[model samples]
Target: MITRIFPSVRRLHRRWFYGLMAMVMAVGIGLATPKPSQAGLLDLIFNGIQYIQLSNLSTQDEVRLGRRIDAQLKRQGVRIYNRDPQIVAYVDQIGQRLAAASARPDLPYTFQVVQDDSINAFATMGGFVYIHTGLMEEAANEAELAGVLAHEIGHIGGRHAVNQMRQIALAQGVAGALGVDQSALVNIGVQLALSLPNSRADEYDADQRGFRTMGQARYAQSGLVSFMRKLDERSGARPEFLSTHPDPGNRVENLEAMLESEGNPNATDGLNNSAYQSKISSL
Candidate 1:
């Protein structure tokens, strides 16, 4: 009986191995040969594995993935502030203004307020931006808050998160093979959005892009620079913004130069500090 059981087990293992090899070969061939529909053989395998490169993710794919990541973030205990509808609406209003003036305005943008008190803001792919309640309170005026939101939108416009995902996949030796599984990619995205510091080049690009967006939206250009200056002057531990977004050595100076180059360094659109504070008094 024992001998018979051992032979059957060996046969079962052999069958499983051959089956896996066949599936892998089929995936390779399907990838090599283009299909008419974007969703083809690749979509059928492994519960809908996306075979495309991360950098080339379509707008729909990016948005879908972002939704998944956002859901997971909520599940992981990142609370969304919903106690006050007005606060969320106000933030969304400012974010929408900046996003409309952004380079990629066609993407559906969703701005959420995080309940946390940390002075940090971040953007994931597919036009999802989150601003902390603390960050809102920290801002002296509406433009300062808008500056942070615009910076986050700039990240989405630049597709910095997608680029970072591709680089991480390559470094992990999975990109060259079957590409990352969708679930794994989503996990990676969550980690990147939460803890990773963006590359120095990406930070500078975001700042420049955000500056332009802010100006285009007619928000006072000084808001961004002033906010950064205020953060830079803070003592004690670095703020989450400074920690997550590495200071590009001279971020404040560069932003000031951009304002100077625009030849209107004194634009005062969103600089009413008293009104701004009154609006956010509930928080």
Candidate 2:
């Protein structure tokens, strides 16, 4: 009898809840339509739906969303390097180490190398991180490469991509009463990962988080600091990294200060430049 009732309840719950939510969303949109500010109405509706869908998004849901965006990105011509499995595995090993020490360790992190040589790395929600071959070549040591991976993981832990999606949803307005369409959200995410710059606040927050994560993972914090300095020197060329992550004023100085405040403990794990180059020599 219990088994019989459980299946019935499960079926009813899905149908009933989704129908009720859809109806409520529709009514809310209709009532919001006449508000003096169309933009304001849209904002209200989006916020309401976003709160229901994204603010409390389950880990499973977020991961599913990430998979869709990642698939779409591959379809749209993002070349992932498969020429060397060793290089790919090396990155994943470092990324896994950082993710384990990160604030959000439960997430299943994936690290992939892109074939591009433009010196950039990016992460979307659900612990997906990508590093460019160029960025790997630019790093002088293992710690520097680890530093970049930690920073990308930091963005995932902070759910900055979700926040960015919220802003995009607000700006574009919802496409339907149900909310920003899932397919649309995937497209927006691809754009965000590929081209859009994170807010200054997001950049600073990721920096702080990444700095902390690096320390926890026992990588030399100076690696992150030095990498930032390298990017700053290239301010004229404006590397894809700096283009995607707007520099908060005094960023390197701030990181240096953080290192100082922590007493700049001597960490010896990833500072071996020769070892790092040998690991990625195939690239």
Specify the highest-TM-score model's number: 1
> Each candidate: what lDDT?
0.87, 0.86
Stretches of candidate 1 exceeding 4 Å from the true structure: 1-46, 50-52, 263-267
lDDT at 184, model 2: 76
Q: Which candidate is the best by lDDT?
A: 1
**Candidate 2 segments whose C-alpha is farther than 4 A from its true place:** 1-52, 175-177, 263-266
lDDT of 2 by residue, 29-140 (tens): 8776755776765776666534226556788878888988899989999899999999999999999989999999999888999999999999988889999999999999
Expressed as tens digits, the lDDT of each residue in 1-283 for candidate 1 is 4545588899999999999999999999987776766454445574655655686689998999999999999999889999989989999999999999999999999999999998999889999999999999999999899888888898999999999998887887766545567887888889888998999889889999999999888899789999999998888988887778888448888998888887245446799999999989998
Q: Estimate TM-scores for all models.
A: 0.82, 0.80
Residue 110 of model 2: what lDDT?
A: 87
Per-prediction tally of clashes:
0, 0
